[model samples]
Target: MNDLLDRLRGILLDTGYTIDGVRERLGAVAAAALSREETVPALRATAGDDPLGLLIRLWWLGAPVPARAAPVGLPVAELAAAGLVAVEDDLVTAAVHLQPWESGGYVVSDRKVRPGDPALRPDHVVGAGGASANLAQLASRRPVGRALDLGTGCGVQVLHLAGRAAEITATDVNPRALELARIGWALSGIEGIDAREGSLFEPVEGERFDLIVSNPPFVISPAGRFTYRESGFSADGFCRDLVRLAPRHLSSGGTCHLLANWLHVRGEDWRDRVGGWLTGTGCDGWVVQRDVQDPAQYVELWLRDAAEQGTPRYRGLYDEWLGWFEAEGVTGVGFGWITLHDSGSLDPVVRVEEYGGQVELPVGEYVDEVLGAVAVAHRMSDAALLASRPVLAAGVLEERIGPPGAEDPARIVLRQTRGLRRSVRVGTVEAALAGVCDGDYPLGPLLDAIAELTGEDPSDLRERAPQALRPLIAEGFFHISTG
Candidate 1:
């Protein structure tokens, strides 16, 4: 199988069946339509009988083609024997979905489940989607000795980790998912992944990793109808447990990045509820809620995910799910990313917030920078912080907003134009501080100078400045100079 996969990879690259090649062939219009799962535009776009076009029509579009018209290097008979494709009546069709990922590799999973199609298998291996990309972007890019990809469906995360981590372990509860993940790893030319079949941290018991990344089965469902998305545990329990267990499996200074969904109860604060999961973990944690949905909307979304909307049990299942939510006191569900760094501090800095603004792509480096800044902020005393020189982060803009012809501005805002795009309201003192923070002078002296210019007491300014600047430093608005 490994030899066959090696040959297949060569043929795929030689035939120009890569991510860029496919995108150029499909064009923007067809590509956008294909994202919405509409195949007509793509089918029309790939009507040519060329090798690339044939591969696209066969694997990507999931359409049957005449066996004689199969691409020259594609091993139809071997693929059929390997259960990757089916041959019947002089026609060939993909038995699985093979997609060219942006990392210049392929991922194989069960065929896309469209509405009105047959029900999904209980152990269906889902393809890489938005959640997979989110976790990948959130992971730190720093080199590490070993990495763990928990619940690695189709092994997409391992492909991204191959360049940095020396050794990788991919684990999944479903055997089929592990099988497909191995196939994906082999085809991507990635080797030596310790593929294990177990739930959560069981496979790696007593072992630690320098980095861990997971896109777990975090759907808050009443029943575990499908293994790919449903954990079979109670509402949000799986995600919470994963967060609590992750720190123990992480070596000192290691980081864990995960995508999760947590319930928003009617009478409880969602921030406190989710933040409590990191308590006593000895890790600096950051949780960002990107989006939220009410109970009804959440139920409908997952129902459609399995293509169960057209089934006879759809209405009954929907009602049952909503009822379970009501009984469990879930008012809504919040989906987001959870990042934990094992800082081994007695007082770990844990931040939970909602961020719906635009952010820069490929945020792995930014995440590492943020964690380093927060660690510094948490460790430094007021005197140490004031003695340190700090500079404003690049692309930070100061905006003063007021009505026309107004003498004084009503609000002053400092906004980041890069990763996270965070904005904070500020007073005149902080605004002046931001304008002069060039890492040339210590903050204490700078504050004294500002007080001298603003007719305030230097002693008073020094007393209150550290409290105001700590958050800015932690959020990456300011970078403290080591020298």
Candidate 2:
């Protein structure tokens, strides 16, 4: 089996059969079509006896191939041994969708059935998909003594975590997923990732980790349709429960990164509802809501996600989900990342805001910087904050917008070219204040200088300066210099 695995790895590398390779082989049009779950374009593109085409068909397209094939072929017997493929009458079909997924490096997991697949089982394991990649990119790559990957479906997170965490523990509720994860780790020749089968924190009850991460079963569905998604918990219960318990399992100064969904009730404020979960957890949580959809839109999105859209069962599932949401007074659903820090503060700081900006990949470092800024503000007083020297982040840029023939600028916007790609509009005073944050002068004196120049009272300007700078400071527009 090891020899077969070695040969398989060689075949993939020798042929350059990676995600980028497949994209290059098929071109942008066909690769993009496949990304939208429309496989016909990809099928037309890969119709040939070429090694790359044969391999694409065997793995992604699920097309039956002759038992004997050349450099394009996978090791049939070994794949069967690993429960990845099944052969009958000299034709091989993929029992599981095996694809070469690349993140920080090579990560392989059984693919989930998409819109193009003819048949699918409830237990189908998902590969390194968008959600997985999102969480991985959002994960802090800082070296740590130990990490926990909660709900490690097919072990994609485990594979990514292995590179950073010294010791890793992976937990899941589904037994089949655990089985496949073990196979994946063994095939990849990666060890020391302890896989356990239990729900949520039950697997690691008495443990404390330096970092805790999860791409959990947070679909917010009414029933347990798929083990990878549903957890038989009420709407958003799985995610809420996980966030509530994460602080207990994290060591002081540790951080927990999670991808989650929270429902928006009709009359209740979503912030208080989601923020309430972290109450008494003794940890600071910063929740960034990336996308929000109404009840109807949310239902349709997940239905298509499961490739059930336009199927005979689509209507029933849609009705079931929509009806449940309507009955429960759910107006919308928000999806995004929740970052928690184990500060053990009694009055934990919670920042819940919507960020619809373009996201740069490997956002963990950026998040860490923002969190650090927020932490500083949490402890510093308004007077102390106004008295601190400051500077703009390295990626910040400013633009003056007005008519081409105009004298003075009408509006000034500060934009971040990296990280979250956030853009903020500032008034004249705020803009001038941002320009002088050179770390040589404190904001209190700067505001007083501006007030004297503009004929405004320095006392009033001092009060307003810190209040105005608070949001910008917390958002990384201005960094308070400790030196």
lDDT (10s digit) by residue, model 2, range 1-483: 657766776787677677788777788898788787778888888887778887788777778777776354567877877677888888887775556667523444456567655545676667768899899889887888989999998788877778788999999998888877776666566787888999999999989999999999889888988888878899999999999999889998899999999999989999898889878778888998889999999888878877886688889989988999999999999999999998766667888888878888789867778787787767778879887898877788889999999988999999988877888999877888777778999888888888888899999988877777878888888889756
Q: Report every candidate's CA lDDT.
A: 0.91, 0.82
What are the C-alpha RMSDs, in order, of all predicted structures?
Answer: 1.2, 2.2
Summarize candidate 1's per-residue lDDT along 280-348 as a digit string, tens digits: 888999999999999999999998889888799999999999999999999999999999998878889
Q: How badly does each model clash, as a count of residue pairs?
A: 0, 0
Q: Against the true structure, what is each candidate's TM-score?
A: 0.98, 0.94
lDDT computed for candidate 2: 0.82
Q: Candidate 1: list runs displaced more than 4 Å.
A: none
